[model samples]
Target: MRQNPERRTALTDAAIEVLAEQGARGLTFRAVDQRAGVPTGTASNYFPNRDALLTQAGRRVFERLDPGPEAVGEALALPRTRASVDRLMHEMVDRITAFPSGHLAMLELRLESTRRPELRAVLTEQIRANLQENIDFHLASGLPGDAETVVHLYLALSWLIVERLTLPDLFDADRTADLITTLVARLIP
Candidate 1:
């Protein structure tokens, strides 16, 4: 197998785009190679099989979606109040929505996972770890929320993102922002 880190990352990123645009059925090595503009067989060299490619794409989506340290620091700088939590929630929605293709690829992986046990395990583990990380951050930041509140927000915001991406006509920006603020205010003590 090739050990070119840059090429591997490119291939996985291309796979993400392919997954988002074409769904699981279109995630072939050739498709990834074409999307990456690499030679045919390039993706196959990096990923042994379709499952490997899908799993890696899932990991890559999270890697692209995870906020940087600067964003985290900024969030931590806010006052520990319900209003601050509301702002944080809005920021999160902005961050997630900023990467539309990454989130769409995530939704694709989720649907694909329902049929593939191995893929299911990988996604479940990654999502759980991300959830726990959010819970830990909320607690350590002295935010106005418990673990349950975080969980509720996670669920609500995740679907809200889906609605925004899949059906933009359903909710405009102001309405979405209002929903997030209301969610945070009601969920946080």
Candidate 2:
């Protein structure tokens, strides 16, 4: 059957929603079909296997979370100063908060990856690509860190963002802002 891009996107999106709401175990083709409100076998038509479906769902989350050129330009075009660092930090937090479900789905995928090495490898590649893209963006945007330092900073900020969003009661917005500000100060030189 000829692949329909729109339909594939729909299936992947549904998969993300299922993964977010129900975690990895609930991410069945039927569940995705139900979530998508499509006919039975619809998800299977797009993804022949569990691995394919899971991988596509992961990719879809990244696609949805990707900041387009305008946001990138706005962040990058700022003067490389302490205030610019603050704006960039705010941007990162805003983005992570904006897509809570996607981030949660990513966390689910991380846990699921541990049980399935194939899933682990797939996620590893995706994460590596994402990290490299961030590092590249950092270099282009003139963030103050070497490549290794930037990677570490990304990892740290990722954990903080995940924690802050997934457990809002644990850290109020002001505290989260304070944490981000301090981290940005240290990480951006």
lDDT of 2 by residue, 106-171 (tens): 999999898889889988998899889988877787766668766766777788888886788888
Task: Please give the CA lDDT of all the candidate structures.
Answer: 0.93, 0.83
* Model 2: how far residue 20 lies from native, Å: 0.9
- Number of the predicted model whose lDDT against the real structure is largest: 1
- Candidate 2 wrongly placed segments (more than 4 Å): none
Q: Which runs of model 1 end up more than 4 angstroms from their true locations? A: none
Lowest lDDT 10-mer window, candidate 1?
Answer: 180-189
Q: Against the true structure, whose TM-score is highest?
A: 1
TM-score of each: 0.98, 0.92
RMSD of 2: 1.6
In order, what is each prediction's RMSD in angstroms?
A: 0.7, 1.6
- Candidate 1, residues 98-157, lDDT tens digits: the string is 988899999999999999999999999999999999999999999987999999999999
